[model samples]
Target chain A: MHAIQQQYWAVRDYLSPVLKESKFKEHGRITPEEFVAAGDFLTYKFPVWTWEKGDPSKARDYLPADKQYLVTRGVPCLRRATSLAYTDADEDAERLLSFGDGSAAGGEAEDWVETHAGRQSNADSAANPGSIDDIPDLDGDGAHEDEGLSSAVGNLSLSGAKVPDTPHLDDIPDMEEDLEDDDDAAAAPSKAAPSSNTVIDGSEIEVANGNLLQVRTYDVMITYDKYYQTPRTWLLGYDENRTPLIPAQIFQDVSADHAFKTVTIETFPHSGTLQAASVHPCKHASVMKKLIERMNAGVVEEQKAQRKSGSKDAKKKWMFRRASGNGKDDKPLPDDEDVEGMRVDFYLVVFLKFIASIVPTIEVDSTTAF
Target chain B: MPVVQFTQFSSLVQPTFWHELTRLKLEVLKLSDASVPLTAHYSAGRTIKDRNTGQEVALGCNFTVGSESFDEKHSLPPFAVVAKGIVKNYNTIDEFKNADKRALFSQAADEIWDSIEKDHDASALNRFLLITFADLKKYKYYYWFAFPALVAHPLWDIEDDWKEAKEQFTDKQLLSLHGHLEASTTPYFLVRPAVAGDGVDIAPVEDYTSFFANVPTDSQTIGFFDPSPHPSSPGWPLRNLLAYLRAVHPTTTSTLRVLCWRDTEPAHESGQWKSRFGVLTGGPAEGKPSAVGWEKNPQGKLGARAADLAPMMDPTRLADQAV
Candidate 1:
């Protein structure tokens, strides 16, 4: 709610191109205050809970120790790409000095302090070689955003931080239902109850496809949808010899959920897949919250059990063991709950990967329980 | 190992913008992670003397201000991603009909996949990306602030006048402070960046270093805090840099954006940060270095503040939990 009051730009230089696109039906410039006011993503229906694995080896470490009843191991989808390097600052002194030559007009010590820092500092410095940009008219009224946001807000309880169950969090809009009722959304599902994602191997009746008849395997990929501004999952399947899987092969897996849930998207929106079965993003916060909470509870329960059975000194020893690393409890711990990569049920992720795809003809399987 | 990370936070938080900030926190994190008790000074655009060339040059300027577009020249410096690969096994429900090793594996795998996807659908779709950004600008930004955190370390130690702490600095270091004092009305800290001896880069050492020059090989502990006059208006890039450095990555100790802006218009009023020796404590002079465990690499010291900021990392505990 930046409203009409704060220092806001009606013109969005950063988002103009994307917002002007037809994908987003509603368009307007967003202010920093309003952007921050949008609040946390946890409040969204299908909040994307990203699980970060630092190295590729990190993913291998996420395998469950006890695979007794394990099915397909969940595939961690690629989300972000990163790079970092630490340089010797002293060595960089030469490099830093050689950087773009900005004028540095020398000024009084009182006139050139640090808070005076900004993107314009260099430009302003370039204007006057040795003087500071303390002159009010030049940049004090310059086009920048609000005063410094003192609160970093990193503790806003979004990334699995302890967010108390508050009533306001429950007011999430029914994004899926609203879309289902809209006409001209070409991809909305026509089938009744039990969505494609839920009807897997269920009793739902199968629908007929024009000429496609074979079931196929495809990788489920989730990408953000510009139209709805939400995450949408798409199917990228393959056959033997690694040839791209046909629409039929991918659709075969969706017999029941297929008829009403998906739209055969011939053109891949942003990924490498040939054609995809697109659908609405699925709901995942609850299950993920359950998994996280259970992990914490398991640790506490194990500690409590140990305390009751062992001597106080042994208990003290156990605490030290966990802290210093390597103990019997540590032995039991790894086998119990080490799967920490971006986690999701392999099937559920595939199912919701395209919640917003296939146009608007089919709707998400809202009634089914995950 | 000290990598500042970022991913698309939310729709409100632009992806490309955040992607640019990914490597930012590393500078402060690594400095604090290093055993060099440090401080951050707002040194943007200040004329700094280059020892190598004997030429006085203006340091960094408010690269984050002037325009709304991403700092076209400086912000998104090219960075390489070192991602690890993962092998994915693909199969369908029909493959489970047979009893071969392949069929059995497919059946089991498909079952777990179905259960998790079906059960955890919502949360799975919501994403918090963890990606890395590596660049020299990140290193520069770190030094820009680290200089102050390094110098502020001395002031944090004593209750009496910090001039007592100033005595510890060498003439060269004091001269740098004089340079800072002469350059701006606001006070700033000055220090020499640490190099790993040889012409090449060195891995993390189990030791600490002094922030200044002409010090004894054994003295890796002091820097000069100059009371340079700071700027009045706040800018976008500097604020973003500070906030990014203080970002919270649960696995790592949290760093706070401790820099602040001061009003130079009302010149007569001296605030809490204003020291007696024409030095005022605002900007990078604010926050203390986060506490680090030193049970691994012991630095010879007495002050509680310095000891807590030691950068020793234990291989054992860190390795036990790879997340």
Candidate 2:
């Protein structure tokens, strides 16, 4: 397996249970096949790869006519190379030997020699032509070509093809240049073009992240005019079996651009005058009426008592006396009076009495309403 | 009938003596019957001239008159009536006997005798009659004095009571009244009772008397007369009526004035009437004439006017003067 693929498996295995508890089930199931599929899908949708140079392979020259088609298709190209070192001559010689019909005698002879000598051979067989195996045929139909093919197959088995440390984009020179250029551009404007050969634009990725997925996500760029802006993306992950898990990195992204617009609700204002309108007007009027009525009744009773005496003159005289007595011992009279010795005339008194009767009621109504 | 006699003669005498005599007559009447006869005689006398100035002058002589009456079968001698006078210049008794001389002597004697008779008659009248007359006069005078006092006293009393009542009224009644008027009823004009210490404008003494006196015959001023002899005796019932009126029509100005009077202090001594009437003290801006001697009461203002009449009159001073 590729090292990257191996690392991915190891991390997934370690984080799977944690991810499940954290509710990121979909991410937990991202196997190599799924990863590759996702990458291919991305590539197809936004292709960034292009031919970088003409095909360069030595295997094509020696291919037979029928096999020549493979070379033309660039299937025989050596996409990766890896270094290997030799430790002992026998292993080296074995690696350098060509595959043939049976080599038991040679293997025995080599073993006998090594046993008699009591030491291992120090020969550099990888560089020696003598280490090459002679061709042998199994059917003995006098088919030399088959003998050579078997020998070639044996050689191929002896040496393994090396894998490259970095994946190369053979068909996409523009993408390579874009990737190189993005390092510098990324520092200045995160929202700038990813690269000339970028498979996906930032806006497309944002739309996908926000709408297409079950757990919506988005990259928000909070801007101060156009000069100052913060770029951030939040990945809201969800799974069929679990709640979504937002990665810490995405949380950091959201927080960095926290000054974004958000939705809110609206409200009103409270005041006394506004509230007063709802009160019952009659309540105040009723209170006023009661007060005035009581007062009027009291006044009437007093007047009746006065009238019954039939001595308004004498009473007035006494009142005068008492009043002149420095108000020392006299009791107070009721609010109203008869016409006999009153300072005002009868008509005025009547008018005033009527007014007094009504005044309290009105005042009461006003206050109550207020 | 027993006759009481009096002798009269022409001479200069003190008016005080006449007054004393009149008093004596009245005292006598208090103790005696009216039909009792009293007699009086006047005697004529000769006057003597100064010897150094011997211009012939009539000689002076004192004479006496005597009255006689039989007490049984025996005759009683008459008592002489005597008098002294300045002699005239006539040379003879014949000259003194002329018409002018006789007329002068008779007239002097008659004048003295008539005065004596009148005094005796006055002394014989009924005691009750005299007492009643004196009392009536005193009462009349007091009526004048008490008019302001009566008016002021009750007014002061009512004023004070109303003051306290007013506070209560404002606290309890007025507020309610205001509320009622504002709410259920149309507000009537406000009527405030006169406050104690709010100066009243009493009429000046002259103006007060004149105002009543000058009132046209057809005017109601004459209506003030009380046909009932003792008007003040039935004071309480009248007061009750006034009080009732006050309550029923608290906004009545007339009733308020009456109440103000009922609540005020009485005027006792002289000058105190001014203070009591609030005329000397002044009163609210009601534009009414003062009840006492009007001098534009300095304390005049709104509401009732209270004056320390006790201080103005100073009963102690009157008492001292009486002593």
Which model scores highest in TM-score?
A: 1
Quote the lDDT for A324 in model 2. Answer: 23
DockQ for each of the predicted structures, in order?
A: 0.01, 0.00
Cα RMSD (angstroms) for every candidate in the order listed:
34.6, 68.1
Task: Write the residue-wise lDDT of candidate 2 on B11-98 in tens digits.
Answer: 1111111222233335644433222221221111111121112211211111111111001121111111212121122222223223
How far is B188's C-alpha from truth in model 2 (Å)? 34
* DockQ of candidate 1, scored on C-alphas against the true complex (2 decimals): 0.01
Mark the 10 consecutive residues where model 1 chain B has the least summed lDDT: B303-312
- Per-residue lDDT of model 1, residues B1-323, tens digit only: 11111110001111112222322233334422211211111222222222222323211121111111223222111110011111111122122112132332233233323322344211111111111112333211110100000111211111222222223433333334334433342321222323542111111111112232343433332121211211221211222222222221112113221122222111222232221121112223233222111000011111100000000111222121111
